[model samples]
Target: MESLQKSLLVTGGAGFIGANFVHYWLNTYPNDKVTVLDALTYAGNKENLASLEGSSNFKFVHGNICDQDLVEQLLQSGEINTIVHFAAESHVDRSITGPDEFIETNIIGTYSLLKAAKKVWLDIPKEQGRQALEHRFHHVSTDEVYGTLELRDPAFTEDTAYAPNSPYSASKAASDHLVRAYHHTYGLEVTTSNCSNNYGPYHFPEKLIPLIVTNILHDKPLPIYGDGKQVRDWLYVEDHARGIDLVLNKGRVGENYNIGGHNEWHNIDIVKLICQLMDQAFENDKTLIEKYPLAILARQAKSEELITYVTDRAGHDRRYAIDAEKSFTELGYRPQESFETGIRKTIEWYLDNDSWWRSLIK
Candidate 1:
């Protein structure tokens, strides 16, 4: 596929996966312009995009996606041809505790973006609509919208029925439906990708991987909810970003794609792997190990002892896996990082960038 000149608006570009995509998009297409609209919520950190602060190709706008006036203004500036919507309240635990934000951000925010896109891209004349034909709205979503899979059930496919279990997943499912409805009803050029669990640099410590890494560093108990047997298909964040790029450029409009690593691991297994890696790192460099408090160092030396089980999360899914064959067959997409390589890299990133995450912790 020929590369099109893309001036993109990346919503929620300050959050974990969104921030990574902003960096990825700028590096991959240096000639393209990117404007990031982020609300700077707790999960959205301006520092995530600090490196791109002065880049000519990048601009960061502080705003909410639900603000229809702001979204329409940005789109009508005629500078943006693509809207990559990523802003959402994505944590399941937080959704259980407080679901209002999930509905407002995930459902209402997505509706606002879609409505604005329709007005800006579809409500114009034939001659002037050439740019609209080239314009695309790419929605990034999660696989949990398909709900859990039994131990022997097949991985989720693009055609899988929506059975969202938590408020977070349900909100995403609603947003997905809205995107599809807009595409079919309004003739809007849109594509959606439901990706598996993503882990990499800039991941907040609240999630499993970074949480375990941080907990181990501090010699705190590694809290495992329930039996830690819940399964998730793990995709490296960069690979997911690459998949998004492929789908945005090459995928058929009005279609949905599934992006995953084809790597499924039990929650406990991932924690244990981090512990083992930490142990090895500490053993290899005693001086590095000494940087931690003495008690932390002692605990880090025997990382497994820190494992502790807690009550399970509400509506915890037993397993989630994705069948990304459609992406591979249609878009020539394939993950570059294996779990072993990706996990090691993620751990090293957290270790090397202490201040980056420490600030978040504070």
Candidate 2:
């Protein structure tokens, strides 16, 4: 690939995975310009990108992807050659309760962006068509679209037929199909990556790792749904960010990639591990034990006692694992953080960045 100058637009850049990607991209390509368009919803926090406020190469725009005018205006600037689409209603539980937002954002929002990209980047300027070919619309997706797997079944590969069970995954599945269709029909350059569960800094507290960590800190119940045996492959957020970078730059056009940590753990096991880690942290660090009065009491009383089993979520999948061999072999991409190392880093981040998460919790 030739070294062409890149001006990128990253959607959902205020959210967990997207913020990490924004940080990673700027650091990796310091000279390149990046425009971040985020809706700043409940899940998207401006504090996540607070560090990049003064950088000349970074610009943040508060907007929704579903707004065709806003999306078109950004693309028409003729600066964004790469569009990393991460905006979506991703929580399965929320999707079940009210699927309207999921459909609006995940399905319709994606179509709007694709349409805008096709028109602004591809449809106009017949003489500059070659330059347009270099523009990439990279769709960041999830592994849930493959549905659940049996305990003994193989992990989902890039070729796995999408069998989305929940509204969240179904909407994502629809968006994924739209991306591929645009590539095949309009010849718009596009690449898609379906990643497993991501855990790391700036993670919303509603997810598994953050929820368990926060609950343990406050001496609250660690709620486990069903038997808590639902297995999910967990990828560290930074590693997923790197994988996205790889796919954007080197992945084959009109192709999809599976990005995973290759580390699968049951939900209950993850909660238990967080409890054990918290216990150890409390024992080793007197300051932590002193900082949170509730945690100190819980440490003395036994943190594991807080575990509570709740009813399973509606239409919950039993397991999800991704086979990322193709990405590893083709794009020279591999996760650097093991589950143990990643979890420790995540816990440490939460311990140190109390204000960052506390504000969100309130």
Clashes of 1: 0
Q: RMSD, model 2, all Cα superposed?
A: 1.5
Worst 10 residues of 1 by lDDT: 292-301
lDDT of 1 by residue, 1-362 (tens): 13679999999999999999999998999999999999999999999999998888888999999999898899877468899999999989999999999999999999999988888777753557454556899999999999999999999999999999999999999999999999999888999999999999999889999988888888788899999999999999999999999998899999999999899999999988889888888878776665665336434468888899999977899999999999999999999999999999999898889888987773
Model 2 lowest lDDT segment of ten: 125-134
Instruction: Tell me model 2's lDDT, rounded to 2 decimals.
Output: 0.91
**In terms of TM-score, which candidate is strongest?**
2
lDDT per residue as tens, model 2, 48-158: 999999999999999999898898898767468899999998999999999999999999999999998998877775556555546889999999999999999999999
Please state the error at residue 69 of candidate 2 in Å.
Answer: 1.7
Estimated TM-score per prediction?
0.96, 0.97
